[model samples]
Target: MAAFRIGEAAQLLGVSADTVRRWVDGGRLPAARDEHGHRVITGTDLAAFARSLAESPSLAGSSARNRLRGIVTAIVKDRVMAQVDIQAGPYRVVSLMSREAVDEMDLRVGSLAVAVIKSTAVVVEKP
Candidate 1:
């Protein structure tokens, strides 16, 4: 792919040229100057930076704040509470002693369950 100029990159990212320059200066976005002092943006560098930004804390926190969806596999109802086995991902998460919440969700085995974990923390990983 052809490299974009600073202005073009700013337009692509929906930001001002100065913001893009700031990112470059902050090492979020990497750029170099030609002999004529023109800022040249590399497509490779842009892609790498985009991947990094996607895994950034801001984006992750916003995503967690967005929503968390899952399913209920089992529910252990007690005298006053219930333990719910929720399958949210590659793992199963359990929420114990939440009778009212379980009832509010109408939770049962094989029922769809959605858990909203609002957090400012961001989790990052590599495959």
Candidate 2:
């Protein structure tokens, strides 16, 4: 249950903060308050919502990309830019990001990563 501020959630959800607020007010979403009493959503709730999206029969076209969460497992520096290997559950994705990001993050075998999938892109893929 990791809490996120409304603005952070809005950024993740790709919506306006006001829209998130309305969902909270309308009970279409849920939020909690900290000791300081600010509205917040938790990572647990977000994961649950992702699971719900997977379970809903109406969204049969959903893509498995939505289920990804990864960790930066390794980096291979080359004559060119470095390559990053992110382990997303049973899947390993090797991708190239800016060397700056790798340096700034100090990305190593244990560095955390969140593989983002914008909702509109959820779709069917060939089995």
- Per-model CA lDDT versus the true structure: 0.73, 0.73
- lDDT at residue 76 of model 1 (Cα atoms): 85
List the lowest-lDDT window of 10 residues for candidate 2: 58-67
Q: For residues 26-124, write the lDDT of model 1, one tens digit per residue.
A: 977878887688887888988787666547465554545433346888888976889888776545777776688778877889887766565577697
- State in Å the error of residue 36, model 2: 1.8
- lDDT tens readout by residue for model 2, 54-91: 58564466553454567888888765578988887557
**Residue range with the least summed lDDT across 10 consecutive positions in model 1:** 60-69
Question: Runs in model 2 with CA error above 4 Å?
Answer: 51-127
Best prediction by TM-score = 2
Clashes of 2: 0
Please give each candidate's TM-score: 0.41, 0.42
Per-candidate clashes, comma-separated:
0, 0
Give the poorly placed runs of model 1, Cα more than 4 Å off: 56-127
